[model samples]
Target: MQLQKLLSLIRQAVDRYNMIAEGDKIAVGVSGGKDSLTLLYALKKLSQFYPKHFTVCAICVDLGYDNTDFTGIDEFCRNLDVPLTLISTQIGKIVMEERKESNPCSLCAKLRKGALVDEAVRLGCTRIAYAHHKDDFVETMLMSMIFQGKFYAFPPVTLFEDKNLRVIRPLMLVEESQVKGFVKRQEFPVLKSPCPIDGTTKRAYAKELVAQLQREHPGTKERLFHAITEGKIEDWALPGV
Candidate 1:
């Protein structure tokens, strides 16, 4: 997707959810992956002309993995004039070595998010922008239904009451496919996850499921996403009722 189209969707989602407030300092979680890197670039560009005038800080929770290199990400952020903060943690050892859980995506995600939020708050970020796109939203909902037996997806805006920080998903309207195209056009320094079960998790399953559904039904993906944005589930209605 072109940068103009990407920013248009991002601005739509941000406005739709009232995500960015005046003077909000948002920490863009940089995983050195395509999704997060796309978010970082989008937010940085948006900050240049966005009316709300929020600042951007790029942060990454390094799980102490040897295969990943963040030097390119640092340069990317530097070129955009955004400060990057990296939080190093032993989450890989804890999850894979000590806990030794076969299905470690859940615990690994929790640890990584916790570490990111800790640093974001300490850096005085009032809010954090996640890289969850439309495909991720649908996949997460599918995961919730199949595994937890409930209908739940991430809210566009979530409040971390304890830390006084708000979570926003500006790229919520952008699709995963769109992000991949953006990454390629921009040559984002995408890194492959070194996790043993990276592609074997419930998310990967749901991704395939969504793709199959789209193939079979022709419009299943759009319909499912409509269900989300139209508030088919409780607590998903847009702000201001």
Candidate 2:
């Protein structure tokens, strides 16, 4: 069932964004989290029957936090027979000791993303794929609107100039709940975020708001997802028109 859902999502993202091509080397960012691990597994399964010729490699960046063991992740990757690369940085210590800000999510995310992209480029990967799902995209949209006063969310595909890498989100059609359920069913090894400021963040608040909306409206998530994919807002006129 997970494989079927993942195949459908892959087809949707590929058709929508033209993300993959024949003979594309893709690197998947695996943080030992449910989302990323699921992405890696799905890609591994898809590669077997994918019409186009493509390759996938798993890369993990260690933020150097105390009591965080990557042994389980290493073993899992070895068992899967996928090549795994580990990059280590002292991001967690730096954020806890030097950063005076209360919320460290943005900074940590930037650092980790940069490191992942660099690794992808260094490993000669033309495309880098992340595990951002439908809920993440919606939460980002809401966060940008409420906090940044902007009407933008993370695109399904983006090209980075510095790294010259094409970044894609294949799980854009899958919901977070589905991802969590799949992870639980598969018993994927999950890594905890070692940042001192994990729970107290603006994104957390936005996520709560989305959850409340989901509870209030049964099919709101599906409708919102449709609006995104179908370009429902393109018909609306801008202010001062």
TM-score computed on alpha carbons, candidate 2: 0.91
Q: Whole-model lDDT for model 2 versus the true structure?
A: 0.80
User: Against the hidden reference, what TM-scores do the models get?
Assistant: 0.96, 0.91
Query: Relative to the unseen true structure, what is the C-alpha lDDT of residue 129 in candidate 2, on a scale of 0 to 100?
Result: 87
Candidate 2 ranges beyond 4 A from true positions: 230-241
User: Which ranges in model 1 have alpha carbons more than 4 Å from their true place?
Assistant: 232-234, 237-241
**Candidate 1, residues 17-68: lDDT per residue as tens digits?**
8999899999998888899999999899999999888899998988987867
Task: Give all candidates' CA lDDT scores.
Answer: 0.89, 0.80
